[model samples]
Target: MEWQVWLSIAGITLSTFLARSTLLVAGSRLRLPPRVESALRFAPACALAAIVLPDLAYVQGVLQFDLHNARLLAGVVATVFFALTRSMTGTIGLGMCAYWALRYLAGP
Candidate 1:
């Protein structure tokens, strides 16, 4: 719609492309130290926790860990599913179902 918007879009696109390309190019030739490689194995789980924990544990700008917090309860159930079955689909489906069931049971 405007020159500034176009420029901003271009800048973001170029930056993203460069950043990802750098990672790909370097990944082909670079060998991480053994210690670093081992540590990197946890990166995915750490990142997932970083993203999901907030939504699971917080509500309306407050931390909620009580029985009324459906998300917390569902997250625990999903974690158990993952631990036992290692199934992503089962985790998500069961977690959402658990959350909805709890929410309904907690009725207004």
Candidate 2:
């Protein structure tokens, strides 16, 4: 709609492309320390937890840790189910079912 907005978007796209391409172009020559390589393996899981944990722990900008919090309850159930069965699909299915059941049972 505006020249400034288009310029900003173009700048961002160019910067992002250059940053990502630099990594791939030099990745073969780049060497990371064993410790850093090992630590980087956890980055994905840490990033996922950083995103998902907050949503499961908070509701409407408020921290909820009680039984009435269906999300929190379902998260716990899912965690236990994962620990026991180690099935990603089953954990997700059970978690959704648990959340829905809790909400339905609690009523509107």
User: In lDDT terms, which candidate is top?
Assistant: 2
- Per-prediction TM-score to the true structure, in the order listed: 0.70, 0.72
- Error at 44, model 1, angstroms: 1.6
| Tens digits of lDDT, candidate 1, 1-108 | 699999999999999989779878777588878999899999999989999999888978799988789999999999999999999998999999999999899997
Residue 84 of model 2, lDDT score: 100
lDDT of 1 at 27: 78
- Stretches of candidate 1 off by over 4 Å are 1-12, 26-38
User: Which residues of candidate 2, in runs, are more than 4 Å off?
Assistant: 1-21
Model 2: per-residue lDDT, tens digit, 1-108? 599999999999999999879879887799989999899989999989999888998989999878889999999999999999999999999999999999999999
Candidate 1 clashes between residue pairs 3 or more apart in a chain or in different chains? none
CA lDDT of each prediction against the hidden true structure: 0.92, 0.94
Model 1 weakest 10-residue run by lDDT: 23-32
Clashes of 2: 0
